[model samples]
Target: MPSSWTVLAVITVLTIYFCKNKRYRWFYIFAKTFRRDFRGFIVYVKTAITARLAKIRNETVVSVFESLVKKHPEKAAFLFEDETWTYAELNKFCNKIARYFRNEGYQKGDCIALMLENRPEYVGIWLGLSKIGVVTALINTNLTNDPLVHSVLAGKCKTIIFGSLYANVVKNVAKDLGFKSFYQFHESTTKEDFEVLPEFIDLRSKLSNISGDILSSRERVLADIQDPLLYIYTSGTTGLPKAAVVTSIRYMFAARGMTFVLRLKSNDVLYTPLPLYHSAGGMLGAGQAVLSGITVALRKKFSASNYWKDCAKYNCTVAQYIGEICRYILVAHNNVEPVKHPVRAILGNGLRPQLWKQFTEKFKIKEVYELYGATEGIANMINLDNQVGAVGFIPWHARWAYPVSLVKCNENTGEPLRDENGHCMECGINEPGLLIGKINQKKSIFAFQGYADQKATEKKILHNVFHDGDSYFNSGDVLVNDEYGYFYFRDRTGDTFRWKGENVSTAEVEAVISNLTQLSDTVVFGVEIPNSEGRAGMAAIVDAHNSLDLHLLSNSIKNNLPSYAVPMFIRVMNSVPLTGTFKLKKIELQADGYDINKVNDKIYFYDTKLKGYAELTKDIYEKIGNGTMNL
Candidate 1:
């Protein structure tokens, strides 16, 4: 061989020659393949490694609260009818309430149920309990006896704090329930006679006796970052609502994700009209306020007509919304000048892709942080960095990554098919798949509090598939991951039914129907239409005693839903069936499919020609079945 320098010179000359020739360049590329793979691996490794580093600690919220109290004591924390609470006053009040709970045989980890409306006291009680490490289970105030009772009992709450407005409902249910203590906030809309318990104590009187010293002492009882903070109930596709144990770690993640992802600041004020019982209102909205030390303007219930006015009044920089809320707001008359408020951003879940651009442009919202997360599911997606209509990507991790698989769904049974390997293969980019959260024992962060039924909880969990001895949380939601790895929501798996070559979610359709205030309640489902390839969209609605404004109702749905998704048949009912927990019972409605001859209830059909829905006469029903009168 030649000298070593000669060999090096020869190699360099060969490399340069190869680089210049396109065909020979392949050899050079082949030689650098390992380096390319190594560089890509480094990027993947870095993203996976630094994923959880930016997560906020649970104590950060309370620390921020303390800072706000010191920096801006007189700033309003909450405003309600004839009442306003300053940050300092609210913090002190919450501390005192927490102390009272601690002194009254309550300890960290104990569950306390809160059944109150959107009021100042509700905030105080929730914040106070959170400070003391008490897991507060929020009961839906609209839920009647059995569901109301089941939720409280399911959460295993020993004590309950309820608004006096729900005293009658609570009293009827409490006698059978084994709650240790009951504290009633002295605020009620009803003056009707109701039984008052002798043991029941007024919240105001208890707070009066607790001095500022007690409040300060109680602040020392700070909870660890991983401790349980909330137990929120989510109604699954089937069964009663199950309580999902929300840890401080998850709450912190939510707070940090909302702040950095949505770019919320201390100066930004958020308008939230969603119920506090829901995760969007509690963790996403209220949690953001606590962590960012931002002001939250609360509304008891959503009112499309009043939504813009409230945003202007509160000088809201951002607003929280759900899919249904957005649809309702869109249906309202378009404003002459959309950029009316100081609002710059809107954040929430389930906003449809079709309505995404319209909502942003019409409302003058600069950004839409369409986040995706179940109340209990560990995996979360935030549209950080202003990626519209797409849930942001999750960094790769062996344990925490959400691998989506397009399951082979059976046409007859409507269930997914499994392979011999048991583990489902991931779908190609842009294809919808059932999103499953990978569970690793070391990194698994969530636990389902579950409903009263343990079997119900077990059914939701899938174990031992990907790794010989691993488990994963079944989110029950279908999602699509694009080439960029950003996820887009498809539909809830079990809730969506095939109809006319398209999948229809009753939740999505009901969202459109529920916007009409004329209906007391609405349930949408798929009913088998004669000669149809799949189920046809149908709606059962509890109309007001007076006749329904069919013209207005049809117009609302047409404006909101696509032609294929809109209910072809509308059945008017005296009442819509619901579970004890206020969840719409669709099973009974689905079973009771439309039959004009057998059904006593009046049915109507959407008359595309009439530009409105009309009564379903026997002749019309037959014509629809015969395809003579198209829906």
Candidate 2:
């Protein structure tokens, strides 16, 4: 047996070795994260108890903002470009807007549509509307023509407040939208075809007479927590966007929850480039700041080239992101090389498992708080253990409080599979299935505030999902929970399909392809093969400068993915467009298929004999169509 000194020496050596190894480092982080989360949980319990004891009612976000304003009057509330607004300044600005809305005869429960870019004004408008107990419909700025009109109408918004940036687009839909009033901000073009309204500057100029008092202001209304605050539109994959109801309670929970998750302080500066319309940006980024008395640096758009510079400029301790933003930064030569930045933690979703370590080490970030939740979904998962690729954990100890369960789902139909007894089958550990959250109104924590459209809301709820009388909100996302109770998001049900009698996850394939530095952007979808029984994997790639090496790419993909999982077809283009929230626009790509004549971009397919991609010519297409080629 070794001596005590020798044993200590051996333990020290092993510890040093494990610390250097990337795989073993997470154990330390997980330990620290676990402790921090436990402390935060205790704080949350105390806060909840205090709120319950106080009988907090008719409490709006404005009340919370006002409280924060009192605490940190001189602190920077918003930092946009070269401008900065203090807490008191922002409060007074919101008060003026609230007064103006009241003067315009806007009442409680009235819906107002706002189509603006990521700016201080956007946040101001949202807060101003909320202060007056009015629900603001945050319309996606990318929407044009019919989709724009449809989103506003779907929310039942009588008034539209748009930015001058979308003047032409809004003008096109103004006449058909039938909005009772229209307002624009900054350089709007007037059209005689429709009823055009004055700019926000004019309204602000007229509202100088309004009082800025918080408690005594007549414009301020005491709104119940259950009352609607925002009508956030969802990404319209199948049809026009549906407005999701976001209650004051849900918004407050998100703000407080994120603050707890990040362990944020009043001094923490959050830098966010994501659009304000998205929940990740609205609630977690700026919203968290509003509740915590922290400063936020809001960027107009995400620029990979300037990301590091912006973070350094703002002295941001926390940054917000989606996967595409990280991928873009990693691909950019300047960003791939290390640069000085103050960002310590990044909070958002869609960080790929493969790029997790690379992103952290390259950027020198401490935490990557990946979260999984829809704008209106009842279920929300946050990764507290710094677990790579996991959206959240469902520890056996706490699973009772968070009643989220995964049920078996058919990959082909994209629906939850019901057992013979008419009960939804719950998936075992490590099994990918549809995730559902129990909706109990009495509990409040598990409550679901669904889409504004009643039919759409009804479509998302799975009645008697597991039991005969219980209700569950269908997440429409497939996830796999491990034996440790850590849940990993697999893919959206609609994005996964059956191929070669196996389920192919588009996200999994995309993660593999995204490993290539040359491919700036990529979208994966299942395309129908003429002679095949099921759909074949296809990738629409954005390769600027067309510098992708086919042989090297084929080998990398082959090593990363299974034979059937490998995308059989590749479409290289100058650009691959993304939606407003930075999600891939795959509907058009799926419709276009692999038709060479229909698409302007170059198309290629795996040539087994050549062991690389080859030009997809008409002759090759004919051979594949007739089952002469074995793919």
Which candidate gets the maximum TM-score versus the true structure? 2
The residue pairs that clash in candidate 2, if any, are none
lDDT of 2 by residue, 128-153 (tens): 88887889999877666555677798
Tens digit per residue, CA lDDT, model 1, 160-194? 88877777777777776767568887664333534
At residue 575, candidate 1 shows an lDDT of: 79
Superposed on all Cα atoms, the candidates' RMSDs to the truth, in angstroms, are 10.3, 13.0
Q: TM-score of each candidate?
A: 0.70, 0.73
- Mark the regions of model 1 whose C-alpha exceeds 4 Å error after superposition: 1-64, 67-72, 79-84, 188-199, 214-222, 335-339, 385-416, 444-457, 495-631
Clashes by residue pair, model 1 = 147-580
Error of 2 at 600 (Å): 16
TM-score, prediction 1: 0.70
User: Global CA lDDT of candidate 2, please?
Assistant: 0.77
